[model samples]
Target: MPESWFVPTIAAPRRPIGRQVFDFDRQIVVMAIVNRTPDSFFDGGRTYGLESAVAAALAAAEAGAGWVDIGGVPFSPDTPDVAVADEIERVVPVVEAVTAVSDVVVSVDTWRADVAAACLAAGASVVNDTSGLRDPELAAVVAVSEATLVITHSRAEPHVHLRAPRYDDVVTEVRAFLAERIEHAVGLGVPESRIVIDPGHDLNKNTLHSLDLTRRFAEIAALGLPTLAAVSNKDFVGEATGLAKPDRLAPSIAAAAVCALAGARILRMHDVAASVAAATMIECILGFREPAFLAHNV
Candidate 1:
């Protein structure tokens, strides 16, 4: 493995998400993805049902995930817009089920304030807005709920694609966008300690842009907030390695390790067990965690 350089300059030492506390200074948190959408790119609607989504969330918690992100709508522009009521119905039940059984932090992934508010009331502690707050009211919802907010960098509107997205410097632009969004959220009454940033790996960006963001992710981390890396099974990983979505685990893990080494505090992933193992190993290697056994050295 390459020499680990996982030092972080986070603005806060601990981030409270609902009932869970993330000590970013000492750990790399694995936030498992539980998509409630039937047409989601990765799982292909595997966990779309309420029972299945709840099971997946519990399974992820059992597999050592620190958080479970539940999404009711796919971010792909190809999918039709889901009504606010439908979106809330799809995700809130799952959130209620998971939070009732596990202490795992639950995050509702949506760009709509109404959906976010409903999920927060249903026990979601984090609002993972991949749209970069296109609906600014979402910030007020998070602020009122005192929930953590993940400000992702995406240039396009929700469910819309940017025609030929361009950035003079992908990393710099992403960093700036996240900073501005964080300021907006704080202004709406959200605290900086409850904020996180994501560079939004492939959302509105091509393969080259996503790769560039991953290569220089530390710059995003330098913004001094908990940086989230959502690089699991993304198109950029497939494009770079010529592997299809189902076969992208190896490259996905590699990309996640790169991001972790680059100072990412949270990893949003689909394969919970594998991701948890990778994160634990990286933590041990970086001296943040001690090995479980020392039999070989003795």
Candidate 2:
């Protein structure tokens, strides 16, 4: 049987979760992705305006997401060229709109430093760069700013991944990739505490590749930095469990829990409440502080 979600590994990381400091404050953080674009792989064309964007951000915040990632450009590999100005214009207003009413931590998911700078100026607190800082200038933005940077691993563009995905040993390759990135960021004067790492699960990886990384998420967290995993409803879920996108909830939660227990700090999930509840329950169980009562619907 799979180990109880509550019982984290015996050899868990010495540090507390990636987000929580000092290994005591354990509120599981759920970050909902608010993609304000017409071309995201999921939830595209739904939140492209100021009002709808606010609604989406508010909805996630209401659903117990501790943070919201407000994405401007459609985050597709085939996405058309997005001028830095265009991205800035698209998300700044949304950042301003969401920050106006909600105090939830807002994150800007873009590769452009200009957009990141503008959004951070507006109110966003995190820069979720999927490119892993390919722009070279992105590190400067993070270096000069206080916003947290979500640096994930991805080699080439997303859609073209199948064509150019290269890895002799994926685990070693990804670890090296992130190591180099973290080293580079530190060289740019970005503090390690503010860096969050994601292994770029499906960005350019095949089903097997994604599954291996997901199962062994600790390898990413072993770097002693807060790691973020956005493996929600990904192709690997379907490949592993034969469940399509919508039906991948169980597997997605399972992946999140495994990574979290292994020391991943930030979990970027679409189903915020569900994943949070699962992680909390797992934490409760793992700590061995048997509750006053156990409730079960099973």
Pick by lDDT: which candidate is best? 1
TM-score: model 2 vs. ground truth:
0.86
Give the residue spans of candidate 2 off by over 4 A.
1-27, 157-164, 288-298
lDDT of 1 by residue, 1-298 (tens): 3342446667667777788787887899999999999999998999998899999999999999999999999999999889999999999999999998899999999999999999999888999999998887998888777799999998888888797788899888888888888888888888898898999999999999999988888788888899999999999999999999989998999999999988998999989899999999999988888998899859
**Per-residue lDDT of 273 in model 1:** 94
All models: lDDT?
0.90, 0.75
Using all chains and alpha carbons, the TM-scores for the candidates as numbered come to 0.97, 0.86
lDDT of 2: 0.75
Please report how far candidate 2 places residue 162 from its true position, in Å: 5.3
Count of clashing residue pairs in every prediction: 0, 1
lDDT of 1 at 75: 92
**Model 2: residue 279 alpha-carbon error in angstroms:** 1.9
Find the 10 residues in a row with the least total lDDT in model 1. 1-10
User: What tens digits encode model 2's per-residue C-alpha lDDT throughout 89-133?
Assistant: 778998888887887888899888888888888988888999888
Model 2, 117: alpha-carbon shift in Å? 0.6
